[model samples]
Target: MKPGPVIRIDFRGGIVSPGDLYNILVAAGRLGLRRASFGLRQQMFLEVDDSIRNALCVELDALGIDYVNNLEGFPNIVSSFPAEEIFITRSWLSEGVYKDIFDAFDFRPRLKVNISDANQSFTPMLTGNINWVAAPGSPHYWHCFIRFPKTNIIYEAPVCAYTNDLASITACLEDQLMKGEMNGDALFGHPAMAHYLWKKAEAHLELPPFNLPYYEGLNRYGNKNWLGIYTREEWLSIDFLKSICRLCLETRIGQFCITPWKSIMIKSIEDADRPRWNALLDQFRINMRHAANELNFQVEDQNPDALALKIFLLKKLNRDDIRTFGICFGIKTRPRSEVFCNILIRRRAMIRLGRWSFWYRYDICCSEEFNPNKRTAWVFSRNNPRWLLPEQLRRAIIAYYDGKSIAASQQVEQSNRQPDKTAVQQIHQCGECLSVYDDPETSFGDLPAQYQCAVCDAPKDAFVPREWEKQSA
Candidate 1:
C-alpha cells in the first residue's frame, strides 16, 4: 500500500505543550489525516496526501511549529521526559531540569543525542552517539559517553558535564569529530585536547551502572497521577488522540511525552482530574492496563508486517502464560535498525524464492545481562520460519536466563563448599546459530544418539564445547 509523505514534528526533549498538540491535531483533521505515529526519538510522524501537502506545510509554518518532510539532516534530541513519574528516576532530573537542558541548546545536533536518567530503563542511555546520563550523587552533573561515528565503541569523557555546558561541549565534540581532528578514543588520549575539553567544560565524571526499570500502565506519583497508554492496533485513531489533547488542555496538563516503548505518557495529572481522564478513557473504550508482556515491546514505526508479527507473538506468549517480566523485546523488519529492547527479533534478508515471490527467515538475540546497551555479544538463534519464531524466542529466552541463574547459584554453592578454589566447566554452543547447549534440567549424556539443535536443526556434532572459569565467591 502506498503511504503519504512523512511529516516530522520534533518535540524537543520529548516535551510538547498540550495547546501545541491540539493545534496540530486540528490542522491534521483539516488535511484529512486519519492517524499519526510516534518516533523512537520522541517526534511525531504524519503521512500527508500530496494534494494537500503544500497546504499542510503552510498551516504548520503559520502556527510556528517546526517540521520537515522526507529529510532528516538533524535528529531530534531524546530525553527521559516520558519516564518522569511513570518510571523510577533521580530527584534532581526533574521536568524543570529537562526543559532547561532543552532550552539551552542553541544549535541542532546532527548526531543522535540522548539525555536520560541512568536509573531508568524506559529511555535507552547508549543508543545516542552523544549519550548523556545523569550522574548519581551529583544533582545536575551528567556522565557523557561519545560513540564514534560508524562504530560501536564508546568513549567516556574525563569528567562529568554540567547541564549548562552540555550544548557547547557536544557542539565542540561534533565539530572536532567531523573535522577529522580527533576520534573519540584519541580525544581522550591527547593531552592538549583533554585539557581543552576539561577547561571548556568543568566537572568530574563518574559513570554509574545502568538498570532498566519496568515501565507500564497507570501509576500514581505522589498526589498527582501519570498514565501510560498503548494499543495493539499500532495506530491510534486521530479522533482519539485529539480527544486526549483536548482533555489535556482542559485539565491544564501542560505537556505530553512520547516514550520509546511506542506509547504516550501524560505526567503531572492532578488528583482532581482523575475522573475526567477516566471518563475520556471510558468514552474511547481504551484499556490502560495491558499485560506486562504486551507493553514492553518495540516495533518499527509504520511497518505493518512487523506490527502484525509482534501482535501474533504477544498473543501466543499470553496464551502460554509465559512470564516475561523485567524484559523488553524489539521486532525489526528492516536490517540495521536501532531499536532498544532486551531481546531482538530480526528478519533475515529476503531470499529469492523464484522470481516474483521471496522467503524470509528470522533470527533472535538476547542482549548481555538483558541490557540492550551491551549488544556486542549477541547470541543468535538459527534462521527459522517466520511463523515459528514466537515459540522459538519464548523457549530460547526462558532457557537462557534460567540456565544463567542456575549456573550462578551452583557457583555460589561450590565456592562455599570449597572456599579456596575456582571451577571451570565446559559447554557447547553452535557457532552459526549461537544457541547454548547447556541446560541444568537437560543433560547432554541423556540425549539421543543422533540429536540436533532444536532451533537450527544443526547436527549434534556441530556443537563445540567451550570452558568458562567460575570464580569462588
Candidate 2:
C-alpha cells in the first residue's frame, strides 16, 4: 500500500463503544503495539510490524472489526461529537439522531462527509465535501453545503430533512459524481436537473445563522459532568485506555468520543461516579486540564516530527504569553494538507539549495474573520522560516481580527450617523447561487462584455443591479 505499517479503523461519527475500543486495543496489543493514535477524522490508527500484518488482519476480520491498511478510498464521516453536551446547540441533535443518520448510510462516501452543529466550532463546518449543518429553525432539517472534490468551490444545497432523505441524497450525489453523470460546476447551471434532484429529495428550506462556541476542559450538562482530556504526546497508552474503558462500562457511560484535536471526551459522568473517575485518573497519572491555548491545535496524525514542531511552537507562544483566545492553529506538514483553523502554519516545498543540504520555508495564512467556517480568502505572509511561524501567526491573528473589529465598529458608528448608501452601487449578483460580484477587482469593469461567473458560469446579463442602484443610476 504506501510503504507503511499502519492500520486505520473508522468509528463512523466518532461514536465508539468503550467495549469495542477495548477489544481493538486488545487486538493491537497482540500485534505487539503498545499505543494507538486517533486521527482528525476520529478514526483509530495503529502502527504494526510488517511481519504480523496478515495475522492482525485475519484477527480483526474474525472479530468483525472494520479497518483499512494504507488506503483511504472512503474517508471517515466526521461529526461534532465533542459538542454533544458540552456546547450550546440550537436544536436537539442527540446521540440517537447521530446513530440513526450514520446507520442509514449504506455506502461508503468517496468524498469527505461532515455532520455538525452550526453553533459549535469543535468540528469544522466546511471541510467536508458534503457538509450537513444542523438548521436552527427546525430540529429535523439541515443546511447542506456541497464542496466540490479537491477544490475550494462550495455550493449550498436545499435544506434537507428526514434521516432517510439525507441518506438518499448523499447516495444519489455520490453516484452522480462517481459515474460522471454530472460535475459540481455543471450541477448549478442546469435548473431542470437541480429541480429533479430537489424534487426527489423533499425538504423545506430555512437559513441558519452560524455561531462558534469554545470547547475545552470540564463542563456541566444538566446535572452530570463531562471531561475533555488532551495530551501533548499524540499517543494514548493502551493500559490507560483500557482502564478508562472499564470505568466507562462500569459507570454505564454508553460512548466515548474522539475530537479532531486528537483529544478524548467522556460524557455523562454520574455525580456519584466523579470521585471514582478522579481516582482512576490519579491512578493512571492522566492530566485533563491542559491550558486553553494548548488545547486548540490541529496536527497531522502519526507524524512525530510535526508533533515535535507543534510542541516547540506552543512552548514558544506560552513563554511569550501570547493571547490565542478564540483562535485555533493548524500545522500543515504534508503537501496540500487541508486544515480547519483560523491561523495556518504551512510547510513549503523543500528546496534543493545544494547537493548536500536542503532548505525549507513556511507560509503563514489567516482567515479573514479568524473563523475556519468563513474561510473565504486567506491573507498570506509567504516565504518564512519554520522558526518564525509562531511569531508570524501571532502578529497576523492580531492584525487581521483586530483591524477587522475596529473597521466594523467604525462602520457601525458611521451608519448610526448617516444612511448606508453603499448599496446603491451597481453590483451584479446571482439569486440562485451563492455568487456575488461586488468587489471592484472582480466587477464588470475588469471582465469581458460576455464574461460569466466562475462558479455557475452564468452570463453577465443574468446578474441584474439592485433596484436602489438602478434608481441611483
Which numbered prediction scores highest in lDDT against the true structure?
1
The residue ranges of model 2 lying beyond 4 angstroms of the native Cα positions read 1-4, 179-218, 350-357, 414-473
- CA-lDDT, candidates in order: 0.74, 0.71
- Give the C-alpha lDDT of model 1: 0.74
RMSD of 2: 7.1
RMSD of each candidate?
6.5, 7.1
Write model 2 residue lDDT over 1-473, tens digit each, in one string. Answer: 12257888888888899999888888878778888778888888888888988888988898898888863557889998667767755457877788889998887788788988756666887888778887655665676777766455667764354554677667766666565533554653444334333322245333232333444456678999987777778778888888889999998998999887777889999888889878887897877667777777787777776677788888988898887766777777665457677777766544445443246677666654565675524435655787777778778767856866887898777755744444445556654333455444344666667554333335667666654443211
lDDT of 1 by residue, 79-107 (tens): 88787756654467887888888988987
